[model samples]
Target: MLKSWTAMFAAGSVISLLVVVSSTSALRGQPQPGLAVASAGSIHLALGNPSGATEDPANKDNFLVSKPQYALSYNDANGIANWVSWRLNKNDLGIQGRCKDSRGRDFFAADDSLPTGFKQIKPDEYDFPVNGFDRGHMAPSADRTANRPDNCATFLMTNMVPQRPNLNRQVWESLESDSRQLVTRNGRELYIIAGPGTKRGTIADNRVMVPASTWKVVVVLDAPELGLAGVNRNTRVIAVNMPNTKTISGNWRSYLVNVDQIEALTGLDLL
Candidate 1:
């Protein structure tokens, strides 16, 4: 079943049809023809297909998978995602009195449904309490609290990468916090895509890949308020590329970059 589904994804039939459904249902205004859209389980989010990158590895090998909160392009060989995409909105956060996954598990776990020959990454692969690396979240847990299931889904190991402790706990965490604030302050929805810029290296007993840096691309829009028509040259886009090392300062905003810069580094076209 999974193989066949991935085959369809490679043929572009599954996600193409899904894009049409997402564009029609999620947007209040007309979406430009042939824009890239990603599905977060049932929710469809828009990506304006920013130009500059020659290609996106996520669309390769049919490993793109969608959960209720985010979509990731898994690289089974490297045991990490090339990118994870998700939709962020006003209602996506702030679950009063609920602060964590109700399952009582704070650890990252394997995704069993992944295709054969791909070993499920373990929670301890991040070298916690030893090498000082953290299992950093790409699609942050804070942004997926629309429901408990949504929040828990973000804990999948595939959505994580090995990050330095200081970078993860300080700067990276700040960026995740800012994403939610951006939505609340603007009164709109945001589309986010994030991933690692990896070098030829491995960490944690060679089980996990080490990212040279981490990057994210965000497209801000007043969706359902201004709709797809709101996306234009003037649309506010925030792109950040931060070092994966411990030397990163407390301010994540210091790494602010343009979408083109991120595209050039990751070979991904993100708007």
Candidate 2:
């Protein structure tokens, strides 16, 4: 499936029915080998991008080229990601490298590098405090604090979606902390993919879609290599689907689910 998708991606412009999409030169750095593309912009994430799902040509879906820190399948019409994928390890936890600017903002401008006709969303456009939602991080910023590029990439509006405040600040935040600890305990790398289930429709002038629920798939591996060889029946896979509402409690663990369930809900091949 990955091979087929790669073939299509290599074809380029096959899915030209998109509303707007953009691409830009990658940042200057040693490219991470093995991945299909070593993002041109910043330091590439260790796990590589996820693949296997085909986009509907009628919709405004497009694969946003991977940046150094993370990669996303962006939906240009709704101005959000279908999914965001990246790698995380204990080394990414502390020691702030030069990923942010002096003004304390993301090094990359919101959607600045997207393809030419794509409708880019800005960071402050969410109006979180006024809109009663948070500009939630699909690839969380706190998890990539180890350096500037990785951390700053998480702030891109392309990596954000409208999330309820309680879910973003409380339960979701706690779960993120736990994920880091899980890596520290096992001493391995984790590949994570997260996105929204936007059954609830849009918010804030219909600019950002409101997901009825948000979901995540975490693949724990002792090494970094593509394919199902590393993941088996016994492989540790964590999947969670949390409601997009204010009633969620602080315990994110309570929302745990199986990877199979997430795959069914998302219609994406995670492995």
Candidate 3:
């Protein structure tokens, strides 16, 4: 089955491969088919899904959504993505810039792709004047600058979580820049997974959960063609669990952690 799936993936039948995997899982009575197999190409999630997310209505918290730019497991109850996964190569970088308004603020659009009845968070919800948080991107806007729609998709509210202004602007932003440098400078391809961890509080009148920490796992491969098959003992995996608080400061490397620790904290298997 693995060999067949690899052949199908190599043939570029990503959607067809997903259908087969889903059908086979149903017949075997396993947990609903995960999106990992569904996203096994140069598209988003070249490695695999960390959480077993599916489109099943019953699994609203871990509902899977695949976009041209990236893939994510959106948690309806929490009103944020459980995790976002994307493949980043040098070709994905461009000068398209971030989707912003005339005021130079990011255009946080509501995601209409979510099914009816799921709470669609609006942009104004993050407009707290006193103790407001920045709309942090799980998959940073800079990572998807290949085109207009690709960059615009990063601004969707589903891809956001309430992050401290300092954390988002400083340390987190630095790491995002460094990730891009890996592609531009070293010519490495990265498979990244990021999400919030441990609800710290509530925002947007309790509509959105503020996570205590933001975690990410970056799998860096020497070349884009290698994909998942390239991962080995020597593969460089950078995982960090940064606190989502104003007091946090300094380099993102200070908050470095092992992948297993991040998995234990967020309850997701990140490879």
Note the clash tally of each candidate: 0, 13, 0
Report the number of the highest-lDDT candidate. 3
The C-alpha lDDT values of all candidates are: 0.64, 0.64, 0.76
Q: Which stretches of candidate 3 lie over 4 Å from their true place?
A: 1-42, 102-104
Ordered by lDDT, highest first, the candidates read 3, 1, 2
Stretches of model 1 off by over 4 angstroms after superposition: 1-45, 48-62, 96-105
Q: What is the C-alpha lDDT profile of model 1 across 1-271, one tens digit per residue?
A: 0011111111111111112222323442222343234332224334522221112334333365656677666776678887887878887877732234357557467776566667688877776787777888998878877776777777789888888888888988887877788787867687788888857478767777888899886666756476544544344556778898878886776787765567678776553
Q: Each prediction's TM-score against the native?
A: 0.76, 0.74, 0.84
Task: For residues 183-245, write the lDDT of model 3, one tens digit per residue.
Answer: 999999987889999999988778899999998877677756756555443456677889998
Candidate 2 per-residue lDDT, tens place, 1-271, comes to 1111111111120111111111112211123343244442323223333342123333357554576667777887778888887777777778775356689654545777776777778766777677777888888887788876667777788888888889998888887777777777777677788988756877657877888889886656655343223433334556788999978885776787655566577776553
Query: Could you tell me the C-alpha RMSD of candidate 1 in Å?
Result: 9.9
